[model samples]
Structures are given as C-alpha cells and as structure tokens.
Target: MKKILYLFLIFLHFSCADAQTFDGSWKGEVNVSGQKLLLVFNLKKDSNANWVGTFESPMQTSLKFPINTIKTHEDSISMDVKAIGLSYTGYLDRDKDVMKGVMKQGNFESAMILVRSENEQSGLSRKQDVFPPYDYIEQDVSFQNAKGNASLAGTLTYPKGGGSFSAVILVNGSGQQNRDSEVFGHRPFKVLADHLSKNGFAVLRYDDRGIGGSKGEVNLATTIDFASDANAAVDFLSKQQMVKTGKIGIIGHSEGALIAEIVAAENDKVNYIALLSGPVLKGDSLLILQSYALGKVAGLSEPALEANKLNNRKLYDILLRDEPPKVLAESLEKELIRQNNGNALTSDMKVKLSPMLIPWFKTFLRIDPAYYLKQVKVPVFASFGGKDIQVPANENIYALQRLHLNTTDVTIKDYPNLNHLFQNAQTGKIEEYFENQESFNEQLMDDLTKWLKLKTK
Candidate 1:
C-alpha cells in the first residue's frame, strides 16, 4: 500500500538530460509489475542553456510537473529524482528521439522507454469515470473539524431534483489523499460518489488534513485524529437541508474503515456504515500478514520470510513496551543488524523505518478493531476483495462475520476476483491496479447502491 501511496509522489518528481541531446519531448512506458504506464518528458534549454524540463503522464494524471537534476554524457542519460528516492538511467538513440532506460525506486526496478511524442492525449481508458455536464449537483465545499483545528475541503454531489436524500461520507485510506482518493491515475472515490449520487444518495468526499484544500498538520495526526474529522463531517452533513440526521452514514476504505468504526461506535447520528478493504486485525498483526503476503509475491524464500516475520513480531512487542524512542530505535537497529547478518540498514532505510516509532503507528499497532466493532449498534456492511493482498479478504471477512456485534444489522460481501479497489482483476497484485483503467467495479456499485437504498428506506 505504501508503494501505491508513493507511486504518484515519485511520478511528481521528474528530471531531464543535457540540453543538446535531450532538448525535446521524450515519451516512455514504465512496466510496473505487470502494468504499463506512459511517461513523457519535455525538455528545453533555458536562456542560460541549462536544461529545464516538465513531466507528464496522460495515463496517470493530467498535471504536469517541473523537474530538475537532468544529466547526459554521450549516449547515456540520467536523472535523479531524490524527492522520492528514484533514479532513471537511460540510453538515447542516435537520432535523439528515443531514450530507453530502467527506473529504480527503492529496491524495485522497472523498464522504461522514452520516445519523442508531442500529440499524445491522456491514454487512460476509464469507462466508468464521469465527466462534466453531470445530471447531479456538484459543489466544492469546506467544513471545520473544530477539535482538530482543521478545515477540510471536498466535493458534495447529490441528485439535482432531490427530496431529503440519504447521504454517505467517503473516507479515504492511509497517506495524504485528496477528495477523490486519487491513485495510479484513477480516482476511485470520485467514480463511487458519482454512482451513489446518481442512485439518489448524496455523497461527500474530502481531502485528508494538510493535503490539497484541507488545512492541518497531517504528519502530526493519527487515526484517532482522523476520526474526529469524519465525525465533524457527519455533524456538518446532518445540518444540511437536504440530509436527514439519522440517514447519514460513512463509507470508509482501508485505514478509513478503522476510523469509521471509531466514529460509528461513538456517534449515535450514524445510521449505517460500510467498510471497503477494511482491516480486521491489530496493526502489528496486519503488518506481519501483509509483509508475508506481499513478500511471497515478490519471490521471497519461505525461510527468509519466516525469519523476517519473527523479527518483526519481536520488534512490535518492543514497541508496545515502555521504552524511550532512542532506546527503541537503537534496539531496532540491533535487530535489523541481526536479521541481516550484521549488514546494517542504509541511512535511508533507517529514516523510512522511523514511522514505526511514530505516535500514529504505535497507536495503530495497539488497536483492536473487534473492540470498536462490538460497541457499534448501527447497520454495517463490510466488503472485501478476494485477491486483495493488502487486506486479505478471507481473514477480514471472517473476522467481521465473527464479531460479537450489537449492531442493528451486519452484512458481509466477498468479491472473489476483485482487488482492494474492487476492480475485476487478474492477480489482485498492487501493480495490476494501475494497469486496469476501470475505476470501480460495476457489480460493487450496484451492490452498494442497492444496499444503501434498502437500509436507508
């Protein structure tokens, strides 16, 4: 999931090569896992003859990014996008119209090719994506999370000629997400909100704190803080003239599902709730499971994986103990050394691992969703994708089904071939997510709309 979280961040950091040999548009395709995405770099010589460049990926997003640190020598071209720990090394053709390269980010490598292209449109083929002239009312809105001292900006969509409609707030997963929960060039929440709005339900999708139009310090916030934001959304929506208090609900995805559990359990105004690719286990346990699952897909040997899991479990136990962060970081460093046979992790790895010591992850590592679910009394709908590697569907579905709920009603649905985003998928691998252009599965929209209509009525 972090990979998906960083994919766009890396894409945003770009660079070109020497002005002489690379002063033109260069288009390339990056094969990430099994998915292929197009990237374009348009480079030019500034007044000083130094190379300046901009990047575009029509298949990913329409935004163009300014890039730096482009270098070239003979037939070799390279760019260091240090912002996301990425480097691209390529060979230019004699005609200087094409550049073939390998992009390395962290430990992952992908083949990339850049050809000269000036007229390439956004190649993304999203059949379910909604465009302008919408039949529904769409408005940009902002609300206050008084407790968190944050202002959240979002889009509100509802049927134009509506009676008081049942409404749902769409909560995004982890990391810094905007209103649409954009990832890999696909806006899942936007597609979902469109569907639900068309089905006679108002939907609100907002940016996470400290992102986009929202205002706050996201790095200092935790899941509990995020719940407060959602609670505020509920409060705001309840006061809307077109929304009835008891008919407002939440649809939380991934980490947002956990926050929804917190909000739903504590707020009586929540009539119903939906969990999409939600976690059912404690954070530490889920991390171990996720590590093993994703590691296997990456062809990690069983013995090495078991060793890694064991080391992680021990570290998690240490994290829960009353120890200073300095001591814990030192201890973790020792553990990493032991796990890697005295090979120390790089400085970057240490920095990356710093999140494990943060207040958010520490709190998350201790959370038990079952504890929150047991307190919820609202109607609940939990869905999982069978091929979801991030949140394994069977474990989550089974855990949700087995919860000792005091809820009004509980419904669990499983999609055998869908990935975390509910796309009909081949391997349920994260890489496959970018390859498929379908935003949200049609069946998922139908099922969710049908359930919401029935529950609200």
Candidate 2:
C-alpha cells in the first residue's frame, strides 16, 4: 500500500525561460486505457529569471512535485519528474501557440498537445467539500507519539455543545499525506470527518510524521511503528473531554487499515474500527496483485503483464531480504536487468528506485494484516471498493472469508463502482481518481456511519 512505482498519481514542477514563450498555463488531455485525464502545466519565470513550472491534474490536485531538470533548446523543451519516473519532451508550435509533447514512463507513452489555459484548479467543485457554517466545532490538536519522538498534529471535530461523543481517528494509507488524507484534491478523510462529526461522533485526522505540523520522521518507521502513533492518538482521544472513554474507534484506509488492526488488537483503548479498502492479503502478495491489476486496467498485453509480474515478484523478493541498502540495491539492480533482458539500469531508473531502499517499504513488504486481524477483539467494519485496482475487492475480501473474528459486531460492505479513494468511479483505475468530482462515496459513508451508530451507541 506504499503507492510506489506502479501508482501513477503524478505532479510536475518546472519553469519557462526568458527566451521561450511558455510563460502561461497549458492544458491537455492524455488517453490511458480509453480514459481521458486532463493535464495542466504552469510555467513562469521566477524573480531570479529562472524558468520554473508546475503540472496539475485538476482532478488529481494533490501533488506539486519538483522535477530533476529542465532543458530547453530554442522551441524544444524536455524535463524529467525523476521521482515518479515520468519524462516529457515537447516543442512549441508558433502558429497554434500550443505545446505538443510526448510523455514517457516505463513502457507507457502518450502524445499530447497543450493549449493555453487560465484555470489553476479545475474539476474541483465537488459536492462533498465542506465549507462555512459548520454544525460541529473544529479545532487544531496535537498529541505525542512518545515512542517515535513525534508530536503529531491534527484537526478534531465534534458536534457543538454535545455530550461526550463516540470518537474515531482517521488513519491514512500509503504515501505522505496531510491530515485530510487528500488525494488529487479529494479529501476523503476531511469529508468523512465532517460527516461523522455532524452525526454525533468525534473525529480526529492527523498528518503523517514529518509531514505538515507533525514533528516526526517516517523514513525509518514501519507499520508497527505507525500503530504506536495510532495508539497514542487513542490515548489522546480517550483523555479528551468531548470523547466517550469507552467508545473510541479508528477508521483506517489502505495501509492505515493494517495499522488499525494492530492497534485494535494490542491497545485496549480502541473499542471499534472501520477499514476502507484495506488489504487482507500479506504485503508481498498485495503488491504483486496490485501491479497485475493496474497493468490489466491499463490494457497491457498478456505477455507484458506476465513479464511485469515476474519482474515485480523478483524485486519484491529482494525487498523481503534483510540485507543492507547497498547489498539490496545491487541485488535489485541485477534482478532489474534480468527482468528486462539484461538491460542496464539507467540513471533515471536508479533515481526512481533510490527511495524504495528505505525501511518502511522493506517492513511493509512482509506485513500481514491477518496476523493482527485475528487478534482484534473490538467491533470491526471492513469495506472494499469492487473496482479498486490498488486493493482489489474480489481477492482481498475473499481472503477475509478465511478470517474468523472474535467480535460479533463485524460489518463488511463492497461498493461495486468505487475506487481506492472511495469515490464513484468509471474504471477504478488510479488515473481515473482525479476525473471524478466526488471525494468519498456518499453511500459508503452513509452505510458506514449507520453501522457506527449501531455499534458505538
């Protein structure tokens, strides 16, 4: 659930030079597997006269990634978002005043033409976004993850002038995120928190360590370590005046769902949990399945999908090893070559991979939610998106059939057209997330809250 290589939620930042006429925003649409995703580029010259730019998916307005380098020669421009293995080459057409380009990442390629556009954020007028005149009291809060030397920052909301309410903490999935668990301008956590707080439940959602106002590092931490943070949140919530002591719960998404299982099993403070698109399979298997599913959705050929599966399986095996970073890198490089027919690792390839050699990914590679789920004695609600390519429901939920929980208040629901982010989706592909206007699916939230009211009350 780390949202690494296979996940294509992208961001780009570059700039136009004084010599080039690329000082304005450019818009285009790229076709991936019969779906159209709008791509925007914002290029301007900074005070230093430096060419700077940014890429936006008005729909996936979650990232503003920094590019490695941008090179320009006359009307031609090239840049690389090395972090996501994305690169682009474009030439300006004077007559049309458009930038025609080709974007390449791994085995995928698409041609695009960008026309001038003034809109900075499009497809963001969502119906679910919360605004002024709240029925709940929202406040900034913080708590110590003493074990991790972290002071986590969060927003807590509850019904105004209410009794001690049943409380739930929102846990995030993969990738670094703020308190809202925002993805592509979609804040599922914020929307869920708003809805829950209005429904007479206290909700607390926080930034990940080393992200936002939180004062901790996630570089060296594992899932178990994050559970410590969640446990600390439970402790903080349990002591809050507005929270019912015996009614504390957690709502985890993706990787956070695994953390929820760990905390619910180990921490008595948690009375219930809600899992959104959580993985039931072991980490390794989940990642493998994720890759295959993503490939299939992208319309990869059978042979290509098979080759990618074999390649990722080998790389994951290397990650499962406990060797040092250097050793692991060497093994990973060798496997990469073998998987690619002896092709050497390019600099860009290494740049994209350097981040994966860390501890979080390694630990996640072997994490098994079932090991902790079996021990969870609290009330549980696990929901999956039928179209969720990241954590496919048919397979992951099927794995749950093998689980025999100790809690009788368990609830499991599947949304046929929802994606990993719980949005109403067309293809459930990652790229499709930004195109939709809905943040968290209304039906899923309604059902989940109904279940919470029953179990918590």
Candidate 3:
C-alpha cells in the first residue's frame, strides 16, 4: 500500500508540472497583401519568474535580434525588444505560451502574434542565390543647369563587354540624400547600378546638388530646379559614346520620381522612366498621410493625433499664405511649445525644422506630378511597396488612375511585403527601419527588368 501511494504521488506531481507551465519558443507569420513572412520568438524563463527571448527573421540579412525585457502578472504579460533604432513591445497570452498584441516604434504600430514553435527551423526561407559582383568606375563631372554650372559626382557601372549599351540615371527622393542614397548601411543606387550593368545595361547615378561632392545649395532649390539637374544628366548620357543615347532612361525614387515626371514632360530625349515609391498626389496630401502614419507608429492617442493633424494643417495654411520664413518659423515654434506641454524648442529640432518647412512646402505645393505624368509620351514603370508607411499604395495608384495616362504603356506594380526603400519588410513598428540592412524587393526588381526589356524591344 505504501509503495502504491508513493507512485500515485509521483504521478500527481508530473501532472501538476505539465498543467502549470507555459514556456518555449514561439513562431508566427505576418501576411501583407499576398506576401507571407515568418517571425520567431525564442522564449525562455529566467530565475526571477520573467521570460526572455530573441526574435529572428530569415529575410533580414544583417543581425539577430535580442529580446531584452519580459514582464508578467496574473493573466497579462508584456515583452520588449530593442534593436537598431527602434523598440518593440507586445502583450503575451494569459498562459504565457503565446503573444497576441501590437508592436510599436517611434510613430508606427502593427499587429503582432506569436505561437509556440514546433521545430527549430528559422522564421522565413533563405535565398539560395545572391547578387553577382560587378566592376564600376567612379567619376566627377560638372553640368550646366538653370541654377548655374553645378558640379555632380557619381559612379558609373558598365557591363564587362564595354560596348555601348542601354543606360539609366538614378534619381533620389526628397531630403539631402547622397548619390547612392545610403540608408541603413545600404547603397541602393549603387546596388541597382551594379545589377543592371551586369544584366547588360549601363547605369549612372549622381549626388543631388549640394550633397556629397556636388556643388550648390539644395535648400534654395525647387522641384523644377532639381529637374534641370536630371536634364543635365540626360544630356551627359546623350553625349557618352559608351551609352546607347536614345535608349537611356531615368529611374527616380520618391521625390526623385516627381522630378523624373517633370524631366520627361519637358524633354523628349528620355526613352523610359521608372518611378519607385514615387508620390502621385499633391504635396499637401502626402504630408497629411505622413502625419497619420507617424501618429499610428508613435502610439499617439486619438485626441493627440487629431491635434497634431490640426497643427499640421495650420502650418500648411500659413505656408500657403506665403508668410515669411521667420514668421512661419516663429508660429511653428509656438505651436510646438503648445504641443509639447509648453516646453522650449530644442535647437536641433528648430534648425532642422526652420529651413526645411518653407522651401520644401513651397516646392511641394508648386509641383503636381500627375499633370506632368499625363504629358509623358514615353514608357513608364512605377512601383510602390504595400507595407510602405510614408507613401500609401492606394493613394499612389489612385493618383495614377486619375492621370488617365496610357494604361497600356504604364506599368504599376505593388509589392505587398516591401517598404518605402524597396526592401522586404516585416510587420512591425517603423523603428525597424533603422535596425535592418537595406534590401530591394525581389519582385520589384524582376518587374523592372521585364518592363525595361519590353521598352527596349
């Protein structure tokens, strides 16, 4: 009888252990549009009754993510991870075996879900092949523009054969992006140039005016002013004996896309245009959308977000009224104080905001890419990433549809899993941007290659 009782106690102990426990690695998948991406959370319990883990993604080529803090109460748990330039937070299940919550960055938010992992496989499938290496030539040249004789600096990537070939000029979006538009340690323009050249197309990508080794001030320039620089690049390409001058095209990203539209409208020399994550709507609408994105990512309350939108609209109105920069700056400072609990403005924020508001607003208000896109007579290929928070895919497509351009000749492809920078992105806070290496959406590149082939034929 004593032996039987001891055995029964042992069985009860084992059953309790199995019933009260919740610990193990968890896996989840986020589906954006039609693209499926995998995410893994390796959760383990520590001595202090806390859970810890690491998040890994097969799509990220840079580094592994460490989960820093995890806290739990009776029926609720929270997890926090800090990687790159962003922070992620999520709420765990009552049993602590699953996580079903939202993730946040500075001003972005997304639904997050995790389940117990059954196997040790990594989150997403890895790519079997990588981009081929190619040789490149770096050059510094000057071009005549409406602003003056501005100096331009960039690298030219050519195929191994060295004969004249179809070429493309890369154009950057807004801000003071360098020739390569370096982001998160990735030079996308350089990468594209190398890829295209290896595939038999010559490529030229240069820094904008006042950036990198280029000469001039971009702060005083307008969208039309930038268009002149693109025209100069086209002129230079036209003169290059090593390039098929009539087959040269312009590939613009973001704000650069607007410039490409203007260039194609004014100059008939451009054979093709590729607009990557470009804006099709007026600048004011874009700003509102950007603000809304920021509000979501930042976790702003409904009231706070509405207030911010009102403030932004006020600033837009002031700018549209043509107020002097100083007056506008002062008004913005006052508004910022009100927004921030009456705190004084930081010098860095003030400096960054002052010169940026008037010039950018003026330029954005004056240029409507749709009008110019309607005038474009050449082939156009435009792409937008569905996960891109800065430029919403629906708005961009709607703008294109309104242009009523040759739908047959205009190609617009939306990659469901990509970001504004054309990278394969996971569903998370916008802060994930600074933490990952830049990657181009494979589908976008494939579509581009196919469209270019069709255009050249």
Candidate 4:
C-alpha cells in the first residue's frame, strides 16, 4: 500500500560457456496479481572494466535503469537499485547458470530465481496512457514552498487560450513521487492532468519536495509540512494569469488525500476536494488494518500474521510515548529483536519495519482524519476502490458517510475491481499496479470531470 515495490529486482542466471562471469542477458519472472511479468537485466563491463548492469521490464517504457552498488566475488553478486531503497544479494550455482537470491526494498524481501535467457522481450502494452498529441497546453513549471525551504517543479497543463479557467492541484500520496505519480511506467497524474485540461480545466501536478527537479529534504517532513507545499501551490495558481482566483481545488491520492484534507480544512482557498483511496481510520487503526489486509493477500499464516499485528501495535504505542527519538528507536530495536525471536522476521521484514521509528511515521500514528474532516466545509468528493487493500473501501466509505452525514455537498462512490491506483484490476494486489497498462480509469475520469464541472460552474 505504501508504494510497495517502486522498483522490483530479480536476480537471474548468467549463462556463458564460462559460468564464472555474470556478463550476459538474464531473465526472471516477477509474480504479481497472479500474473508472471518477465524482467530482464543486462550486465556488462564498461570501458573502465567495472561491471555495470541495466534493468528492463516488459511492462515499463524505460528499457534500462542502471543498477548501482554492484559487488561481485567469483560466484556471488550483490547490487542496489539506483535512487531507491532497494538491494539484491544472490549466489550463483557452480554447476548451473541459475542464481538464487532475495530482493530487499525497505523492509520487504522476496525470494527470486534468475534464469539464463538469450533474448529480452517487451510484451506488455499500455492501452490506456495518453501519449502526446497535445489537446491542451502543457509546460514545465516550478514553484516554492518557502516554509519548507523547498523548490518544487512539475508540469502545468491547461486548455489553450484559457481565460481565467477553473484549476485543480494534484497531490501525490506517500513516498517520493515525481509529478506523474509514476509507478511501473503508468503515470496517473499525467493522464489525469491531460484529461482535465482537455475538458477545459487547468491542472498542476508537481514533484514532491527533494525529488526530481524539486529541492528539499523529505526525511524530516510530516503530512502537515506537505500541506504547506499545497498551500504554496494555491498561491502560485492565484498568480497565474490564466487561472481564476478563488476557484482552485485539490485532487489528492492516498496519503495526499490526507494532506489535502488538512489544507482544505485550514485554508479557505481550496474550494473543492477529491480524496482518492484516502484512509478514513485514525492513523494507528489505519496502519493496523493495512498490515492485516496486505498480509492476508500475501497468504501469511494466521499465527505469524497475528504476531506481526501485535508487534506493530506495541511499536505504534511506543512511538506515542514522551521520549526522545533515539530512546524510541532503541526501544523499537529491542522490541524488534524480541519479536524476531519470539517469531521470525525475515531480513526483508526488518526493511519494512524500520520506518516506524521515523518522525513522519510517528506523526502519522498520532493524527486522525476525522479531526480534519469535521473542520472542512468545502464540497468534498471521495472515491475508493472496492478491492483496495491499502485503504479498504468499505471502511473509508462508511466513515466518510458518517462524518459527512450532516455536511452538505459531500459525495462518496466506490468503484468495483479498481485497485489503489484506480486501475481496473484483478485481485487488486500491489504488483498489479505494474502489470496493468491503464493509467487512470476512464470511468473515474468521467466521474471526476463531471463533478468538477458542476462544482466550478
């Protein structure tokens, strides 16, 4: 749910007459949503005689993303994916071309096998992403969030010959994203911005602070800090000659939805708000539910899953204590050790669990969306995917229905079979996000555009 597998690594066997070297084409299948995705990696020696590797996936457009931190010893290899917190360690078989290893990202790791392949294939197709035939004006835009000491850059798309048109700001969910909310080559924000701009609305979708063209440190920032970035965006929009003043709205996805709620509640400048797959539960409850749901989908055993839940609750409780962060981290480390023995947490598990001690996560555990929702008086449109394990549609929809019961101009709709990214999906697994070609669902765009038109008119 938390941008699981922004990058996936699978170690594949290298077959040359000489099995001692890892230079050649390697292929492996990545299992996602009951589908097998072919991942190919090309490893070679550069002119400097150092080993370099590039990754390719049938589902993505980029044929090669360079692999960093490559370390090779006779028959064993290890590497890290550049620009993301992902690492891989694998051992080669002396008798075969096969390599067995685990891919670790954050605290999640999965066992993978690499097979020797002579050729790479690109078979997956994106039937839904809009490529450039410019139905609207699009420009690279930069703005500042002075409070956070960050300069954010993004794409601003609007109808050509605009005259004070209604505008919307697209806010990304958790994790670092670059304007497009791009994952697995699917750019939902790009698709959304294009759709809305063509329909006569202006849209600004920007990179998170410290990512892409944006400049700032994200480690110390919280959701409230991100809301300040949105506030700055509103200021920027107001200054745009083509944007109508006091008519800016926000469409936030996942954690971005929470940030939008915070902004809309406090800032009267946000006229309308759309929450996509937003959590309805308080922070702690949401975390617990997310863990349970994802674990369930991964087919985790009941006892092991319950142990994880207990450990998570204890850790979240520890985060709220009046103690210094160092002290809290120590406490968490001790608890993790205890939990690992009382039950086992795989090496990958540690990668997943380590974030709980961070300041952003601590702040997240203490806040409740209800607190902000009660204060928001603007028109609200909240949509959830029925199969969203991340936010769990029924819980969010019900919570919003109850919270907005007395508030006028609130609409909540659940789209069946759509995943967290709003892709029409099967099983709604995180891996499906990469496998599916459609960016933003067409029905969703229609619903959102229709609502925005009515609200602005």
User: Each model's TM-score?
Assistant: 0.78, 0.78, 0.67, 0.76
**Model 1 TM-score on a 0 to 1 scale:** 0.78
Q: Give the per-residue lDDT digits (tens) of candidate 4, residues 3-70.
A: 22211111111222333777766655543432335566677899999999877665556656778778
What C-alpha lDDT values do all the predictions have? 0.75, 0.75, 0.64, 0.75
User: By the TM-score metric, which is better: model 2 or model 3?
Assistant: 2
lDDT of 2 by residue, 1-457 (tens): 1332122221110112224566676666664543346666677777997777776565455787666667777667787777778778876642123455688779988755565544455444567888868999999999998887889999999998868999999999875567888655567788999999889999999988766788776667777788888899999999999888799999999888989999999889898899988889998788778877766775656886676677677788887887888999899887766755677765544544654676777787788889898998988899999889888999988898778877777788989988888888877755455456789888998999999999876
Would you give me the overall lDDT of model 4? Answer: 0.75
Q: Any idea how many clashes model 4 has?
A: 6
Residue 296 of model 3, lDDT score: 58
Candidate 2 wrongly placed segments (more than 4 Å): 1-39, 42-77, 80-123
- Write down the worst ten-residue block by lDDT for model 3: 5-14
- Candidate 4 segments whose C-alpha is farther than 4 A from its true place: 1-87, 90-124, 342-353, 404-406
Q: After superposition, how far is residue 152 of candidate 4 from its true place, in Å?
A: 1.1
Q: Distance (Å) between predicted and true CA of 51, model 3?
A: 24
Off by over 4 Å in 3: 1-147, 330-358, 406-408
Cα lDDT of model 1 by residue, 1-457, tens digit: 1222311111100112324366666665554533446676777889998777776667667787676678876566777665556677876532244455677779988655565544434365677777898989999999999899999999999999767899999998877677888765577899999889888999999988866788886656778999999999999889888886689999999888988999999998898999988899877788777766665664556975687678778878888887898998898778766755677676534643566777777777788889899998988889988888778887777777777789758888999999888899876655555457788888988998899999999
RMSD of 2: 9.8
> Model 1, which residues run further than 4 Å from truth?
1-78, 81-122
Checking candidate 4 for backbone clashes, the offending pairs are 12-114, 13-114, 106-351, 107-348, 107-351, 107-352
Error of 3 at 255 (Å): 0.8
